[model samples]
Target: MSIITTATALLADIAVETDRTDAVQAFVKQETILVQITTADGLQGTGYAYTIGTGGTSVLSLLQEHLLPLLVGEDARNVEALWQRLFATTRATTTGAITSLALAAVDTAVWDLRCKRAGEPLWRLAGGHRREVPVYDTEGGWLHLGTDDLVKSALAAQQAGWAGVKIKVGKPHVFEDAERLRAVREAVGPSLHIMTDANQSQTISSALQLAAALEPYDPYWLEEPMPADDLSGHARLARSTRIPVAVGESMYSIMQFRNYLEAGAASIVQVDAARIGGITPWLKVAHMAESHNVMVCPHFLMELHVSLVAAVPNGKFVEYIPQLRAVTRSEMTVRDGVALAPDEPGIGIDWDMDAIDNRRVS
Candidate 1:
C-alpha cells in the first residue's frame, strides 16, 4: 500500500469573463481551493473545490488545519475508508458548504490517485456506461440578458448542435419569464429541448404560476423554484406543475437527496460533485438516483462532471459552463450536441501550475 507522504492545499481566484446573474446572487469570481496528495511511491493525485466568490479561504483552512493532516501516512488506495474517516471526523460540519467543499478536494484527489494507479481513465473506472453525454447551454441564459438576446443565444446554441438551452427565470413578473421562454421556443422550434431555472428564487405559489405560464413552451424541466431546504414546497410544486421538477445543486448531503427523492420533490437530480463531497459520494448519489429511476444532470464543473455523467447509465446531461478553461490545459469537446469524456488516465483536467500559482491568494 502506498502511504500518503505529503498533503497540500492552496487557493486561487479566477474572474468570470462577463457579469453573470441569477435570481439569488451575482456570480462575481470563482475562489478555487486545490488539493494535492503525494504517496511514498512518488505518485500524486490532485483535486479541487470552489465557491462562487466567498468562503474559499475557509475551505482552504479546513483542508490544511483539519482534513489534510488525517491523510498523512494513511493508505492512498483506500479511498472509501478515508472518505468515511474524514466524514466522521468532520461531523460537526456534516451538513454545510465549507465542510463539504473541503472534503471534496481531499476525496477527489484520492480518486484521481486510485484511477492513475489502475491506469484507467476516470470514466471507465467510474463504470463506463457511455463515453459521450449530451450538453446544454447555461452560460447564455443569465437573467440579465434581454429576451431578444436570449432568443439569439438559444438559436446560436441550437445551430451549434447543443442538446438543449437553459434560460434563467425569476424575472420581476411571471409574464416576463414566460415571454422569454416563449420567444426562445418560437425561435428554436418544437424539437429543441428547453430548461428553466429560478435559482431558488420563488415562493411555491410563484413557482406554480411560472410553471403554468411556461407549460405551453414544453420546457424539459423547471429547476430550483424555491430554496433548497423546502422539500414539502418542492413536492407541492412538482405535483402541481406539468413541467418536470429538477433540483439538487444547492443540496449538501446524500440524505438531503434521499429526502427530495423519497418525497418526489425532484424528477431530475442536479447534484454538484464538489458540493456533495467529491466522486465517492457523487457516485453514491448517482447510483441512488438510478435505483429510483431518476436521471442525473449535474451542475457546473463540466470538465470534471462530463466524465462522471458519462460513467453511469442513468447520467443524462452535462451543463456547459467554461469557468475553468483559463487554469486548465484542455476544454471538453462537444461533438453533435454531446460532450465527450476525456480519455486521460485520471480526472480529465491538466492544471496549469503557473496559472494557478499566479492567481494563488493563500
Candidate 2:
C-alpha cells in the first residue's frame, strides 16, 4: 500500500470575469482551497474546493491543522475508509460548510490518486455512462444585465449551439423578471430551453407568484427560488409551478439531498461536487437521484463537473461558466452543445503550478 507521505493545502483567490450579481450577493471572487497529496511511491494528486467570497482561509486552516495530518501514513488507496475516518473525526462540523469543503479537498485528492494509479480517466474510473453531456450557458444571463444585452447574449448562445440559456431572476418586481424571460423567450423562440435561477432570494409566496408569472415563457426549470433550507417551501413551489424545480447547490450532505429528493421538493439536482464533500458523495447523490428517476445537472466548476456528469447515466446538463482559465492548463471542450469529458488520467484538471504558486494565499 502506498502511504500518504506529504499533504499540503493552500488558498488561491481567482477573480470572476465580471461583477456577477444575483439576488443574494455579488460574486466578487472565488476563494479556492487547493490540496496536494503525495504518496510514498512518488505519486502526487491534487484537489480543490471553494468559497464564493470569504472563509477560504478557514478551509485551508481546517485542512492543514486538523484534516491533512489525519492522512499521514494512511493507505492512499483506501479512499472510502479515509473519507469515513475524516468525516467521523470531524463530526463537530458534520453539517456545515467548512468541514464539507475541507473533506472535499482531501477526498478529491484521494480520488485523483486512485484514478492515476489505475491509469484511467476519472469518468471511466467512476462509471463511464457517456462521453459527452449537453451544455448550457449561465454567464450570459446575470441578473444585472439589461434586457437588450440579455436577449443578445441568449441569441448568441443559441446560435453557438448551446443546449440552453440560464437567466437570473429576482428583479425589483415580479413583472420585471417576467418581462425579461418573455423577451428572451420571444427572441429565442419556442424550441430552445430557458432555465431561470433566483439564487435563493424569494419567499415561498414570492416564488409561487414569480413561477406563475414566468410560466408563459415556458422555462425549463425554476432554480433556487427560495433559501435552500426551506424544504417545505420548495415542495409547495414544486407543486404549484408548471416549471420543474431545480436545486441542491447550497446543500452540503447526502442527507440534505435525500430530504429534498424524497420530499419531491426538487426535480433537478444541481449537486456541486466540491460543496457536497468531493466526488465520493457526489456520485452517491447522483446515483440516488438516478434511483428516484431525477436528473443531475451539477452547478459550477464546469471543468470538473463535465467529467462527473458524463460519468453517470442520469447526468443531464453541464452549466457553462468557466473559472479556471488562468490557473489551469486544460479547458473543457464543448462542441455542438455537448461537452466532451477529458480522457486524461486522474481528475482531468491540468493545474498550472506557476499560476497556482503566484496566486497562493496560504
Candidate 3:
C-alpha cells in the first residue's frame, strides 16, 4: 500500500472569490494546479496548489517540465526522499520560490493519498492536538474597499461570531492609515482581538512610526509591517515597538523561520502552505515555531489550515478571508468564534467541480 506509480497532473481553472470592493484592494484571480495520484489499490487522492495572478501557467510549466518526471514511479510514501530529490535536482535551474512552490503541489497530493488510504483525517494522522482553532475573520484591505467599507466589514465579521479581525494599513500617508485603524478598532469594540497587516507594504521608519501611532488601540500583532525578507529590519522594529511583530507568508523554508526566530523578527509566525512547499515543510516550521515559543498563525488555505493549527500546541488564530467559501463545495463552519476541523479522511477538501469548470481558462 504505497504510492509507487506515477500519474498525470490535472490543471484546473479555479475562480476563487475575494470580498474586496474597488476601494480596499483589487480582487485576485487564481490559476489552481490540482494534482491527481492513483494508488495501486485504485484509490485516488487529490491535492491542490494555486499560483495567483499571471505567473500560474509558468509555475505549472515548471512542475511539468522539471518536477513531474522525477516523481513518475517513486514511492509516494517516501515523501522526504522525493522532496529531497526534487530540491537537489532543481538546485541549478531554480532553487527557491519557483521550485519550492512546485514541490508544494507534489507533496500535498502525496499527503492526500496517504491520508485517504489510512481512512483518517489529516489532523488525526498528523497527531490531533486540538479539536477546533479560534478564527479571526481577516478583512479590511483590498485597495478597493474604502475606509468606510472597511469599517462595515469589520463590524460584519464581529456580528458573525469571529473572535478577531484583521485590517489592512500602509496607506500613502501615515495619519490616514492611523485613522482607518482607529475606525475599525472602534467598530470591533474593546473585547475582540484586532490585528493589522501591511502585506509587506511599508518602509522601516514608516512601520515603526505606524506601530507607535496605533499602540493606543492595542493590536494583537502588527503583521508584515515591512517586507518578509528584512529580518534584521523586522527585528529592529520589534525591539522598538511594543506591538508584537507578526511575520511569515513570505518565508519559504525552515531556515527562514529559524532566522526569524533567532532574530526575534516576529512574535507570531504565519505560514502559507502553497508558499512554503506544502504540509511537510509547514509542519517543520510549526514545530520549530512551537519550540521557540512563537505563535503559529497560518495564512490562507483556511480549510487545510484548520487541521494544521489543530495539530499544533502553539497554534494561534487561523486567518479567515472567506474567498474560498463561495467556491469550495464544503465551506468552513465557524461557530461562536471557533473554526471546527473536518472529521473526514484526508485533508477533507470537497472540491466544487462546477466552480473549477467555470473558472478554467485553458
Q: Write one digit per residue (lDDT tens) for candidate 1, span 1-362.
A: 48999999999999996778998899989999999999999999999999999999999989889989999999998888999999999998889999999989998899899989998889999999999899999988999999889999899899988889999999999999999999999999998899999999999888889899999999999999999999999999999988999999999999999999999999999999999999999999999999999999999999899999999999999999898888988789999989999998888889998999999995
In order, the Cα lDDT scores of the candidates are 0.93, 0.93, 0.78
User: What is candidate 3's lDDT per residue for 1-362, written digit by digit as tens?
Assistant: 47556655556655546544322244466667776777666777777777655567766788878778877667777778877888788777543666677778888888888887788888778768986889987655555467888788778777877778787777777787778778878877887788888878888998888898889888888888887788899999999988999998877888988999999887999988878888888999999998889889998788888888988888878888665654577887788889988888888788776776676656
| Model 1 error, position 70 (Å) | 0.9
Ranking by lDDT: 2, 1, 3
In model 2, which residue pairs have backbone atoms overlapping below 3 Å? none
Q: Which regions of candidate 3 deviate over 4 angstroms?
A: 19-25, 93-95, 140-143, 325-327
User: C-alpha displacement of 140 in model 3, angstroms?
Assistant: 4.2
Task: Give one digit per residue, the lDDT tens place, for model 2 in 141-250.
Answer: 99999999999989998998888999999998999999999999999999889999999999998999999999999999999999999999999999998899999999
Backbone clashes in each candidate structure, one number apiece? 0, 0, 12
TM-score of each: 0.99, 0.99, 0.93
